[model samples]
Target: MDINRMQDKIIAEFENLATAVNKFSYFRHLKKISNGSQPMDPEDKNDRNLVTGCSRKVWVTAYKEDGRIFFKADSEHSITRGLVNLLLKVYSGHTVSTITNTDLYFLHEIKLFNYLSASWMRDFLSVIQRIKSLAIVQHLDAAPRS
Candidate 1:
């Protein structure tokens, strides 16, 4: 699905779900869809992909293939894992331009930002920035050297 459709679907899913329990359950569902069987390894969990400022360790990795982006992530906690999974669901398989230009306004519409602490918010933004930076680097690398 396109980014717009995915955004709307995510907003609707979160808005439709009631209670933190349900929300977390839905996030796990998304994680299952994204992560499948193999998850990030212990060795890969280092300073490179680790999301700083989070209460728990979170690692996110991104790559590009045939102009489309892919992401893999894992977190020390279930809730954060779910969050990363949700983001990857929306972000992965898109072009660098699409990923970079997209706005994550649905996060606010889902009321997730409201419940986040200052540190969590910083970590959340860091995840987003990491994703965009990866896209930027990939785009630049793919560009023809003039």
Candidate 2:
């Protein structure tokens, strides 16, 4: 996928998400959503509900229907939950190849990656690698299914 197109699409989609929360707004939302909510289930996984590595344990459940990927995810940390929502808002409904091969540089473009802690940076990269890895796996899975 083209970088410009990808970024443009992300921006558009995020803008449409009502509040379009950035880090601050996200934290605000997280604080509100942190009222002892249970984590989402990983047992009910479908084809796309997977994330490989993360500092805070996370479960991403995805379903690609009608050429749109719908994702439901949860995590232990408030910030992680927020991040999951952010990721789903963009990558949830896209095809494995559309997600994997794209130049979807999300961190900087999203304007939140810049404020990340050094430790969080490592976690962030790991999570991203996990997503890419899964996308690649699914792409291969879609190949012949032999």
Candidate 3:
């Protein structure tokens, strides 16, 4: 699925929930699901994969398969994990160009900024930067050595 469609699906899911508390519950639910389905390897939780500038410890790892970038991330904080999972849902399995070019408008559409504290929002932005940087590294590594 494309990024916009995935984002729209998330927005729709949020639209069903009537309250801020329910929205937070939804994030926890996403975190639980991500924990079960995408456990980060212990080796991958090292310094190289660790995302800096975040209040929490978040690790993001990326690799390319069949010319598409895939990411696996884990965070010490549940809400942070859920937020990153949301990003992964949209960005993973996309080409480097697609991932780099796409703008994540879902954050505003879902009104996520209202729920986040300044530190958490900063952490979220850091996670996004980490994902993009990893995608760029994958792209450079895949380039032909002319």
Residue range 40-110, candidate 1, lDDT tens digits: 77777889888766677888777779988888888877666777777787888899989988988778777
Global lDDT for candidate 1? 0.75
Give TM per candidate. 0.79, 0.62, 0.90
Which tens-of-lDDT digit does each residue in 1-146 have in candidate 3?
98889989988877776665565576666566457548889989898888999889999999999999999999877768888888998899999999989988888987888778799899989998989999999989998998
Among the numbered candidates, top TM-score falls to 3
**In order, what lDDT does every prediction score?**
0.75, 0.58, 0.85
Worst 10 residues of 2 by lDDT: 30-39
Candidate 2 local lDDT, 102-141, one digit each (tens): 6656546555665677766666666666665665665554
lDDT score for residue 107 of model 1: 84
Q: Identify the superior model by lDDT, candidate 1 or candidate 2.
A: 1
Model 1 has a clash total of 0
Q: How close is candidate 2 to the true structure, as a TM-score?
A: 0.62
Q: lDDT-based ranking, best first?
A: 3, 1, 2
